[model samples]
Target: MKQELTELLCRKSFKYSEEPAFKLVSGRMSKFYVNCKPTTLDPRGMFLAGHLVFDAIRTANVTGVGGLTFGADPIAVAAAFASGLKDQPIQAFSIRKTRKDHGIVRWIEGDLTPGQRVAIIDDVATTGGSTIRAIERARSEGLDVVRAVVLVDRQEGGLENIREHVADVSAVITRDELVEQWTATARP
Candidate 1:
């Protein structure tokens, strides 16, 4: 499953160049770029990602899985769906980038409550800034963030950065893995 997903991402989402040509969210130029949405939104990609992420967090004893909105949304939902199929049953949640001003006035949307164990997930981790922000926000809302997961780690200190907030941090795929797969298949 991992191999299939790697290939799919290489073909559909990963891009590389001999020189640093891609601009990252952190405003740095990168030799490669990864936009997981194209892959995560696909049916097969979702299946593989769902199972992979579920496998990573299955033993964490988390009742919910989620992270900052947009990037983490699909992966969290997919993991939740996969968990249900596996009978582990973890719910999915989303953390808003901005606070809600109406009614509830909350940063999270889900069937979760304060103090429930949850895992923060994201599609990609570059500087790990977004994931860290999610962790902070979750903590502020009274959620217990026990674990963190990223679909793709840029291998640029992201995991290490996230470890400052949560000891348990992991990535389903790394920049090196994608680069290796991309290089292997790019040969004529």
Candidate 2:
């Protein structure tokens, strides 16, 4: 399953460049990019993502899964959706970058409450800023962030930084792994 998902990501989402390396949100430059949305939003990608995440958290017994919106939205929904299919439903939640200022006037959306155990997730972790922010928000809301997970870890100190706050941190795949796969496929 892991191999299948990695191949899917490499074929459907990963991109590489050497001339003007890809510019990252963190202001860093890289020779490759992993736009997981193409895969995460795909039907098969969604299924694999959800099932993979469900398997990762199955033994953890977290009440919910979530992270910063946009990036984490589909992944969280997919996982929650998969969990339900397995009869062990876990709720989904999303955290906004800022408060709505109107309506609910809150930062978090969905059926999340204080003091629940959740695993924070992100599409990719370059510097871990977004993931950490999500963790901060979760903590502020009184939720216990038991795990930090990402679809891809760029391995650029993001996971290491994340480990400073959360004891358990992991990624489904890494940038290096994708690069290797991409390189292999590119060969004659």
Candidate 3:
């Protein structure tokens, strides 16, 4: 499954070049970019992602999974659904960038409750800002963020930065690994 997912990502989501290099959200130019939307939205990709995430966090004893909105939306939902299929049945949540002005003025959406262990996740980790923000909001609500996970880690020091606050952090695949795979397959 891991090999298959890596290949799919390399073929469908990963792109590389030296000239006119890709621009990252962090405002840096890069030789490659990974847009996980294609993979995360695909049925097989979504299945593999959920299972991989569930496998990573299942040992953490988390009751829920979530992260910053949009990027984490599909990931969290997929993990939650996969967990249910596995009979673990974890909940899913999303952290809003800004608290709603009306109603409960909540920062998190979904069935999350205070004092539950959760694994925060995102489609990709560049600077870890989104994951950190999600952690902040979750912690504010008294949720224990036991682990942080990303679909891909750019290995650009974001993981180290996040480790300053989070003890457990992981990425299913690293930028280096993807690059290696892409390089290997690029040649005839």
Candidate 4:
């Protein structure tokens, strides 16, 4: 089922065209980029992912999900939708890279109280820096983080680094799995 999820994401990504380039958080550049926005931000895929997330969370005994903005946004949205479908009910939250200089001057978004148990969800985990930062912010804001779920894991030591801060890290696909699948199919 997780493999199905990864394949779906790979198919959903919008390919780059003309002078294509991307600087991944892993510091790797490739002409082929997985523009997840096409898959995650879409209506159908979004709905499907939401249901999948809700199913996974049913066993985690978790209450909420959150992470840094952008990459994590889609999954958080999915969680929100799935929560409704599962009748499990969960909220999505967002963390800022830094506190805003103005307005509410907030760092965490959503209904975060000082001692809520929440889960972290993101599209990808490369270096784990962003995940760590989000966890830190969540802790400071008083949330008991149960675990994390990344749509794709770069298999680049990110999982280990994240363990220091969060309960556990789960991924639908790892970097090795991605490479293996890509290689297996490319040998035409």
Best by lDDT: 1
lDDT of 4 at 85: 71
Give the worst 10-residue stretch by lDDT in candidate 4. 11-20
> Scored by CA lDDT, what does every candidate get?
0.95, 0.88, 0.89, 0.73
- Give per-residue lDDT, candidate 3, residue 152: 92
Q: What is the lDDT of candidate 3?
A: 0.89
What are the per-residue Cα lDDT tens digits for candidate 1 across 22-94?
9987798989899999999999999999999999999999999998989889899999999999999999999
Indicate whether candidate 2 or candidate 3 has the larger TM-score: 3
Query: Residue 117 in model 1: shift from native, Å?
Result: 0.4
Cα displacement (angstroms), candidate 4, residue 33, comes to 4.7
| Minimal lDDT window, size 10, model 1 | 23-32
Ranking of candidates on TM-score, top first: 1, 3, 2, 4
Q: Which residue runs of candidate 3 sit more than 4 Å off their true CA positions?
A: none
Candidate 3 Cα deviation (angstroms), residue 139: 0.9
TM-score preference between candidates 1 and 3, better one: 1
Cα lDDT for residue 6, candidate 2: 87
TM-score of structure candidate 4: 0.82
- Displacement of the residue 101 alpha carbon in candidate 3, Å: 1.4
lDDT of 2 at 112: 75
The estimated TM-scores of all candidates read 0.98, 0.94, 0.95, 0.82
Better of 1 and 3 by lDDT: 1
Q: Model 3: how large is the Cα RMSD against the reference?
A: 1.3
The regions of model 4 sitting more than 4 angstroms off are 14-22, 26-34, 183-188
